[model samples]
Target: MALSTHVPDLAALELLLGVAQEGSLNSAARAAGVSQQAVSARIRAMEAQTGVTLVHRSPRGSRLTAEGVMIAEWAARLLEAAAEVDAGIAALRADRRARLRVSASLTIAEQLLPGWLASFRAAGRVGDAAPEIVLTAINTATVITHVTEGTADIGFTEGPQRPAGLHGRVVGHDRLAVVVAPDHPWAGRRPRNPWPVREGTILQGARAA
Candidate 1:
């Protein structure tokens, strides 16, 4: 079945995640125990729905466009929460109050979560916790808002600052990259020096200036 990109509709998100991790549609299909055709179809469907060219395909393999990379990062978090839910449930089976509140970025919310929840549900092992798992998805800005407001118990985001009035744990790390097209004259040297010297740019994201 073809996947949709407008919102990834669960199955499509899974496919995007597989492709991101595997780096090749064929490998993703193999790992997923599906056919290459299926993977291709999924990608096509997503691209159509989202109206974005998400993948750059070449002989080497496939790489994500900016949006694709963003989506993949988000999906990883959703995947993590799903894992926690499963572990919590497994622990609960042995112990019933195993609930947690997870706050994530919009990208993670849309691309790769339902499957994790679905898998946990399929396990059929109930958690001992209260069984109320709340999920909230917001941007880097709103995550801080949720944290500051004490509305969220946990947060996942790319923001480097530790906002006041909340405790944060580094559940994941992501690095921004500088990309220069292959046709550019600096492609060779660019690899050697990923970060170019700054001229007038000021760094505002870091804490304490």
Candidate 2:
């Protein structure tokens, strides 16, 4: 992993933002609920990694340099992303005991599961009152396996393998497609080859049929 790609610990990023706004290392430390000396060490470590002088220290206060402005902006965004991640995990824990436990393939997991679950909750389909949904991602076969083993109350699959003991319900229709940039000559063709996508990439998802 590249060091630049390495997101610094959240505490340090918070401290940096505080220092930028407060204009004093001591004040930043107090705002962040850390020792003034600890704040000094954090600033030193951050500067060493990025090779930019983020703050100019004086007897009265500290001021951010030009590079510091850019770093502070990006750091603020990182902190926001971190908070979102935390909230997502918290929701998972809270909803784990939901009335409906659903397993689905990646396609349905990303595009359909959220909206379906929301509608299900609004309509209270699983039970009398609003029921929470516990959603999981798996391959087509895995979804069937989980359902059979009683791991999931319901499952959605795309491919054509119907294992014994469980009934397959055709809930919806889906079709895969291939397309390229508008400038490509094949843009006029109804059916294009999937060769446009390199490994680890999918050119298109289902279009509105």
Candidate 3:
């Protein structure tokens, strides 16, 4: 539902509550970082807008009348609810930031990522709010696609070269070797490294382990 036109704005309500709490316009103005004139003007405006006398201002100081006290009490409740709404929105934003979306190849996701995530959680490098990891285990091609298409925040692949439109770094290394049976002649005979290929599994993210 739309807000009622009769209600004062938050700033005016806040000032009203401040006046009630401080028991003086000058003190409320000082607390609100405004001049006393401005505070008086705002209170007058609030009274005009609500058609209610909200303050009893004297030469010595200012005081809330009976109606003013009731209005101030209602304003206090409204301000508290506003504060709760603000805090809830802030927490939602924090939760969104504290999530890490990851796309990794099957090998890295299955063989290596679990240990890395465990260590990352235990290290407390990101302070108390450790990021929740949303991991997607897929083939190397799809991993690159996820990063390129912006479906994933980070990606890992077993490709030698970096994918286009994305920065890459080698987080971990592995070697590929030919496997043979014990009865096979190549198993017993020591041969020079047939294929000396440096396999780099790149993990693309804000930071890598």
Error of 3 at 24 (Å): 1.4
Better-scoring candidate (TM-score), 2 or 3: 3
Better of 1 and 2 by lDDT: 2
Give the lDDT of residue 190 in candidate 1.
38
Model 3, 122-179: lDDT tens digits are 8765568568899999998898887777678788888578776677888867766788
Q: Give the range of the ten consecutive residues with the poorest summed lDDT in model 2.
A: 200-209
Against the reference, the lDDT scores of all candidates come to 0.66, 0.73, 0.84
TM-score of each: 0.38, 0.47, 0.55
Clashing pairs in 1: 5-46, 74-108, 92-128, 96-128, 96-129, 97-128, 97-129, 97-130, 98-129
Residues 1-209, candidate 1: write the lDDT tens digits.
76443666656777788888888788889999999998888898888888878788888877778888788788788877877998988886544235545566675556544655566556654543234568887776776666555566555565556655455555444445667899988676636544433121101222220
* 1-209: candidate 2 lDDT, tens digit per residue: 55664456777788889988887888888888889999989888988877788888777667788888788889999999989999999888556544667888888789877887788778865347677677789887777777777777778777544556676655666555665799899787765444332111111112210
Off by over 4 Å in 2: 1-7, 99-209
Q: Model 1: residues >4 Å from true position, as ranges? A: 1-5, 58-61, 90-209
Best by TM-score: 3
